[model samples]
Target: MNSASDAVKEIVIEIVNSTPFWTAFSACFIAYLNRNKGKKLTAEKDGVKFSLENMNHHEMTEALEDAKKIMVSDNGKKPT
Candidate 1:
């Protein structure tokens, strides 16, 4: 590669690898990717299903209970 391109590549690698000043680009990039996922809550039964990305306390509780019931009924058997 050309010197200029090689220098740019080296700088990017250093930015991603350095952590002393918490200036690592990779750290921020990973955090940004995780931040986009948010929280996911889901419940499914036979042919029915429910999902929540953002939910209230009441909804969270209800969804969790539904999930528990479905899990209990599975009785150690795994889905195909």
Candidate 2:
């Protein structure tokens, strides 16, 4: 019984230590992360969608400027 259990344990450890298993696991994990990292719109108006992940530097700066303008116009009042 002890020998059989040891054999099973070794087999499980071998499978876990194999390169193919690690490679497959890494590929799946990367795919999962990439899938989740995709562009997600935070706001939309007049058919224009805003997504930080998809924006280039210029677009981000423009959005930041627009937000600053809105904030300034609001003068500490939260929009309802």
Candidate 3:
């Protein structure tokens, strides 16, 4: 019983000491999973939402042009 309790205490101590490393590893793994290159983007306005992932070539080009026009017209200020 005494040796068994000592082994459990050692295991607990090891886990506590390794917490920070495991936490960092988990964070890096999650960040790698969420890396944004080539990720789908969604736009929302007036409660309407659409995903660019579903758009094809023509639609995507048109959306890009519309976005450019809006930016130019707004002079780059946030719209209220």
What are the per-residue Cα lDDT tens digits for candidate 1 across 1-80? 57998999988766534443223322433343346564333446444565544544444444444222332121232322
lDDT of 3 by residue, 1-80 (tens): 56988999998767645645445533443343246434445544244455544555455444443231211111232323
Clashes of 2: 0
Off by over 4 Å in 1: 1-41, 45-47, 66-68, 71-80
The true-versus-predicted C-alpha distance at residue 4 of model 3, in Å, is: 76
Best by lDDT: 2
Per-prediction TM-score? 0.28, 0.39, 0.26
Candidate 3 lands at a TM-score of: 0.26
**Candidate 2 segments exceeding 4 Å error:** 1-3, 38-80
Model 3 — which ten-residue stretch has the worst lDDT?
66-75
Worst 10 residues of 2 by lDDT: 66-75
Evaluation by lDDT, superior candidate among 1 and 3: 3
TM-score of 1: 0.28
Q: What value does the lDDT take at residue 46 in candidate 1? A: 46
